[model samples]
Target: MQPTSELVFAQLKSKNSNTRCFDCDTKESDWCSVSHGIFLCLKCAGKHRGFGVHISFVKSVTMDTWQFKHLQMMKAGGNEELHEFFDFYELGNYAPEDKYRTKAAYYYREMIKTVSEGRVLDREKPSIDEGKIIVEEQKRVMPQKVIEKAAEKDPQNIKALIGDAFEYTKDLGRNIKEKVSDVSIADVENKAKEAFSKIESKVDSWNFKEKFNSVKTKTEGVYNKIAAKAKKAMKKITEEQDFDDSKLVEGEDELMLDPQGKNGKK
Candidate 1:
């Protein structure tokens, strides 16, 4: 019996394979290039489409209707398999200027050529034993700190770390506020002054007088530039208002002096 689309998707998700785009490693890839057998993000998929059907036949995993045969083929030819085949010995070292995009395109072209010429290897389905070995190897090589962090549910996920940091800062602020709820404004000011005094004394004792003066001079320069801009803006506005007021006063005086004016004649 042919494999269903649901079955194929489940298999891919279980392996955590193709969760990221093959080109840029962007997460939550929604598109797949059938010819190259690699998952891609929307932007990368558009690039693949530009290569035409002969090069890469792109499809949306969610939006497009899938054929059983196509699904079976995808299940057999996953992203990891395609990557291993195309990036053998990791020959495509991406330069800073190429930014992986060029390398990705090259791999796609190579993969398409391999598929069309029947040079593609037969990929065996990953077994439970292989999965266990991969996990064991990762645990063996990973640092103690990294493993502990992962155990705390803070793996090397950048987005998650950023979110955690934001939340931590917010909680810290809230805790500080609660702790200082009963403290008077004067007390807080005194505490701040004491802290600055200690910092200044330490800086002086450290013989960092030259560095401190340099920093102070730079800060003063920035302040002066900002003050100058503000003064210029205020002067422009005052001059404009004065000009308008003078014109109004001149018009009033002319009307008062003119005998032909109705109010003046009265």
Candidate 2:
């Protein structure tokens, strides 16, 4: 039997996490991406709309009516699960390299197909107190007296520390690029390394090399797989052009590159 609109609304309300926008972290979600089974704020929903229906099938949570199929898609995915997938795949990092989202389409297809097949796509995170997560975030950026106090007592949070450190560099790069027309790669890299080094000096337990090596391994594995698929997609309609090699006698001292077909007859 098909579910009614009221039941879908009830399901949406039952999950407390559904109240938060998955993308912007807004307090209230007025829209949803039915394709991904994640809630969105009005602002984020508009952004998703720009991504095209192939990326996100968005609709209003309160205003738009829902069908049974939509509910099934919603059940297959949720905010946190998709968040894990996004973080694991490092989709944000791909945005710069993938302006056309040609490779990104493969990831979306794989994730959705896996989810619809009822298979897990990401590693499950161990349960942590919600307050601690909030405090860890605040401690990185807010610089409040209370947050600093909390951080002094809390065990080292490596993920948050490194993630924020990278985030700072990303923001710095964007700001610098906007102001300066031409910025060299070395300058940005040096500045980012300097910033990250300062943060790493403070964290005693974070083995950045080990973590980076693991990331490098995972990234290469995924990249090689996708590259194989992409290699097969190229379409060639033209036959090979055979160039004349008669212009060169055996053991020619110099090869002429002039357009004139008459050799030495200019």
Candidate 3:
């Protein structure tokens, strides 16, 4: 393949006035060659394949930055130049020479900065009550204070030591509830059951039954509410004429009951 400039040089000098290509125009001569040929003229071609276009003939450090550049160009905030830079930045050749490595490094640095700025790290902290822990993460600030506390008491006074070490029950409850608010109720119930089982192991069998029944009652109430809402939505959809029967039948296992024939009372 002839170099881009050579191809353009030949096209520009070609006798046919038809050689001039226009990107915005559909004229046949507007694009006599492939690639940068979409727009004719030395100046436009220079801007695209030469001039400000960065071509790294070297290949030392990773060229991963170029890959990210392409991705960003494909997803940039409407920056045409940056998109083009990403698209054709590696026009010349790659490997052996270490020239392009510098340019590649520059783009890689930009990518690292962009990625770092967009990420948030997770941190774990001990809760005040000491019975539970809090895991936190966000754009800024430490979560240590919310979880851990310090207290001092003379060894001679056990009551005072317990009092100082124990977090207020109300405060602990509020903090625990808030921490688990994002988890599903089922998850909370599972955790509670596990804890209950742990306690039952140390206690008599009769005590376990009462705790189990209490948990079951709460779970049933939740299940009833969810089932009721789902049934209501299904009823509404069944009443709608536009609902596709074929698609409905495709999910037969999900249906609560067989669809009675088209007639009433099914």
Lowest summed lDDT across 10 adjacent residues in model 3 is found at 56-65
lDDT of 2 by residue, 1-266 (tens): 77776677678668888879987678977677776788888656655554544556667666566766677677677778766655554554444124214333335444665676677667333232221121111222322442343345443664465455545544553343221223333454455456556665665543444443333333233223323322232122112211111112321111121112233221
- List of clashing residue pairs for candidate 2: none
lDDT of 3 by residue, 1-266 (tens): 32344343354435343343332222333211121112233222222222111221111011112233332222221112222433354422332123123343234334433543454323222222321112122222112221122111122332232232222221222222222223344554454344335433543334334433443344333333333333433454322211111111222211111112221121
TM-score of 2: 0.39
Model 1 C-alpha lDDT per residue in residues 143-224, reported as the tens digit of each score:
2343343334423442233233233322322222222323333443344334334334544222243433333333233223
The residue ranges of model 3 lying beyond 4 angstroms of the native Cα positions read 1-204, 238-266
Q: Would you estimate the TM-scores of all the predictions?
A: 0.36, 0.39, 0.18
| Overall lDDT per candidate, in order of appearance | 0.44, 0.48, 0.28
Q: What 10-residue stretch in candidate 1 is worst by lDDT?
A: 131-140
RMSD of each: 27.0, 21.9, 24.5
Give the number of the best model, judged by TM-score.
Answer: 2
